[model samples]
Target: MRRMDTKTTTEKTGETGDNAESPEGAGSAGADIAAKTTEPVEAAEAAPAVEPLDADALGPADEVDKDDDEDDDEALFPDEAPASASAGIGGAAAAVVSAALGVVALTGTWTGKVVAERETLIGQIKTSGSGTPAQQISEIYADAWHSVALVNGVLSLVALLVAVLVLALPGRPSWVRAVAVAGAVLGGLGLLLSVGTYFDLFLNLPTAGS
Candidate 1:
């Protein structure tokens, strides 16, 4: 019985030793597999990254995009050209009419002055004359001069109003604006002068008999 026990114990020890050696061999194999898997991953990570595309090098696509943008701008601006020209013409016409009316006002003012001066001179001559033909002629001319002054004053006032309306209008050109401003100034002055002359002529009219 003792000898059988010894042989069994030796056989068990030999089996345990083989089991330990098998575990070591398995561990070495597992480490080699892990190392191989990690090497490929590290190599991929270490490689240089791909460069992004440059905007300047987008050759045909960028040019096509720029051409489309230019076409859009042309569509927006150039198509409405005629309407802008028409507006400019209208603005110029209004300024011209206002300037012409200013000239008319200035002319009426000058005419009023001439009539007023003649009436005054005639009145003086009539006072100096006594039951003479010249006195009769002076009386008739004085009435005509007074009538002329009234008409001239009304005409000048109309011109002044027209000029003011033109100035109030929109989109005037540079030259047109200059002319309108000049018209306004001259028309205003002439309006005041003519109004005063008309009033004076009426007040200083010769008595009906003279």
Candidate 2:
């Protein structure tokens, strides 16, 4: 019976020790788990502070990116000219036409008419007799000259209008501007000559055989 009691007591002691070891092991495992859980948070707190992204620091780079995008957009259409440049070319064409017409009217058509009419009047004067016939021929020649001069004056006025149109056009070329100025000068001179001839301001033609 004593041997049986000794064996029983030894089993009880082993059970108590197993229970104590299990509790210690469970507490140590819980402590390890808790440490693992909070270790990352502690490490994060101990690390260096991270700065926020600064928007102003990227401003120049963003502007460069925008400039590149704009360049790409502009390069998309390689053949088309700007609207203002096209308009300037059209204006130059108009100026050329207007100036050319003005020059021709003042120098070619009106001058030819004046020369022809003057020749006719001189012929009539040379062939007239010293009488009422001569007087009538002289009067007719004077009237005809005045009428031709008036017609020339109207033509010069038309040329002046054309010159003004040329000069007023937008973005004319240098040559076009020069032509317009020349046309204006010639038109003005033609106008003066026409007025002078019409009023007989500078001319004294022989009349009635004189």
Candidate 3:
């Protein structure tokens, strides 16, 4: 009986020790897990800061971009066309106008009729409506118009001759220039005579064929 009692006491003591050891091991394991979780959080909070990107740090790429922009500007604008074509057109228009005026003066009976009226050698012109009287007056004036035409032709011929001689002169003599001036004066005189004759035709002559 005594041996049996001793064995029971030993067994009881062993169970109590096992129960205490299990509780201590569970507490230590829970503490270790909590430390592991909080340690990662602390490390994350103490991490180093990251730097921000700056535009000025782009280096040679910025210069290349500026150069490209300048090249684009140069390509957009070009030089203007020259003024020679416009000047040539203006000069040609002036020449055409001069030619038109010259043609009108040449073809129209502007000078001959005027000269015919001033000459008394033709005879007195009648303003009367009598057809024969008017016809005779026009006939008389017709001769004067012809004479005026001859005078103009002769003056033009003299002018041409003087111009030729002057141009031929090696020294371009003053006398040759004087001859040209004289020819111009004579031509003016002829035109004056034509104007006077035309005035007479209107004044002394009839309005119509009569």
Candidate with the greatest lDDT versus the true structure? 2
- Arranged by TM-score with the best first, the candidates are 2, 1, 3
Which sections of candidate 2 miss by over 4 Å? 1-25, 41-76, 108-140, 161-172
Better by lDDT, candidate 3 or 1: 1
Among these predicted structures, which one has the highest TM-score?
Answer: 2
- Each prediction's TM-score against the native? 0.43, 0.56, 0.27
Candidates' C-alpha lDDT: 0.70, 0.73, 0.55
Q: Give the per-residue lDDT digits (tens) of candidate 1, residues 1-210.
A: 999999999999999888778988789899999999999999999999999999778989989999999889988898566676887777677666766766776675566667667776666666665645456545655555655657665665665666666668776666877876776776677667666665664356455456
Among all windows of ten consecutive residues in candidate 1, which has the lowest summed lDDT? Answer: 201-210
Candidate achieving higher lDDT, 2 or 3: 2
Models, CA RMSD each: 11.5, 7.2, 17.0
Clashes, model 3: 5
Instruction: Write the residue-wise lDDT of candidate 3 on 64-100 in tens digits.
Output: 9999997787677645434765554444443333333
Candidate 2 residue-wise lDDT, 42-105, digit = tens: 9999999989989999999999999999889889977777898877766566556555545554
